[model samples]
Target: MNKQFIVNLPVRQLDKSKAFFSALGFSFKAEFTNENAAFMIVVEDCIYAMLTTEPFFQSLTGKPVARATEANEVVLCLSCESREEVDSLIAKAAAAGARIPHPAEDHGFMYDQGFEDIDGHLWNLVWTESQA
Candidate 1:
């Protein structure tokens, strides 16, 4: 069965968040995006990230959103085809105002790194060797 997934994140500024992600080579679905939220297409039609305004997101959850900068929330990870791709993407993210929390790590079969976006959302980029 085919399934679609969406991860919602609250951002203080919609346009700023959109620009940040766009600089990192992400595209948003115009049909689902508007003034209050942007539907970021992470993986074709299967995976997506909804960047929403604080008030709009709050209305959906009916609770106070977690302060991503001060609290440990979700860590969204994306897989890359190679170590170079992982490093390249991290560089783009940094150039787009993302904060690098640490250096990349090489663990034999995997190489990984992480960055916090403009909204303080943590994201991990990883490249893993495929076993034959």
Candidate 2:
């Protein structure tokens, strides 16, 4: 059986968030979209970024949403093919107006970079020897 994953994130404006991610090369599954949320496909792994309004998200969890800018409860990590691939993606994100966390890390064994999406959702794009 194939496994699938969907990471739900709270957004202030669904349309804006959808556009932002679309610019980053993620396409939405219209069948899973609604006024309250959208299911954006990240890769063929059945990964979906479920963007829901803040109010609707709050309904799912009573606790206050962690400001993804200050800190993130979840770090959406993805593996890349090479160090160059990692660098290219980070550069593209910066061009898209995303903020890169200071102090990029690189060791022989691993390479990882962090960025904050427009709505402050943190995503970690990483590449490791094994993944490469």
TM per candidate: 0.97, 0.86
Residue 53 shift from truth in candidate 1, angstroms: 0.3
- Model 2, 44-63: lDDT tens digits are 76677899998889999997
Once fitted onto the true fold, the runs of candidate 2 whose alpha carbons sit more than 4 angstroms away are none
Q: Write the per-residue lDDT of candidate 1 for residues 41-126, one digit (tens) a residue.
A: 99996999999999999999899999999997989999999999999999999999999999999998999999999989999999
Judged by lDDT against the true structure, how good is candidate 1? 0.94
Worst 10 residues of 1 by lDDT: 123-132
Positional deviation of residue 129's Cα in model 1 after best superposition, in angstroms? 0.3
Q: What is the C-alpha RMSD of each candidate to the true structure, in Å?
A: 1.2, 2.0
Model 2: colliding residue pairs: none
List the global CA lDDT of all models: 0.94, 0.83
